[model samples]
Target: MAEKKANPALMKPLTPSPELAAVVGSDPLPRPEVVSKVWDYIKKHDLQNPQNKREIIADEKLQPVFGKDRVTMFEMNKHLSRHLHS
Candidate 1:
């Protein structure tokens, strides 16, 4: 059997917008890494709603990226897409 390689596009480093940079830093990073860093920040700040783990409560720095006080975990990627560029 042959092995499949990871998609190059997903591995490519991307720049984050100013709003996202506040949470994940300004360094160019792969999409997965960016997501991971954002999760780390969320955990560090205890931003996830205890009553509803699927919902994330936005902090001051996250307000711009989230565009609301709260959002579902599934919607986070949708919002994040707007702030990333190659």
Candidate 2:
């Protein structure tokens, strides 16, 4: 059998739950899409702390996923995995 490689697109997309939708919107999207949207929101909102670029300020919708008021960008990916399934 040939070796299998992970397809970036095959990853399941995460849909915003009701609570999340209140902040992000009602759109159901893939994990990558969600992440991109979150990043866009962060950038547009200037949520990143100037002293720490790695840190991301969690808005109301993202607070549940992050489990904290703030998270490092690296931690964002880690936390996002919990909200997704294979």
Worst 10 residues of 2 by lDDT: 15-24
TM-score of each: 0.94, 0.70
lDDT tens digits by residue: candidate 1, 1-86: 88998789988999999999999999999998999998999999999999999999999998999999999999999999899999
The TM-score obtained by model 2 is 0.70
lDDT of 2 at 23: 51
Q: In model 2, which regions exceed 4 Å deviation? A: 1-11
Off by over 4 Å in 1: 1-4
Candidate 2: deviation at residue 30, Å?
1.5
How many pairs of residues collide in model 2?
Answer: 2
- In Å, residue 47's CA in model 1 sits off its true spot by 0.5
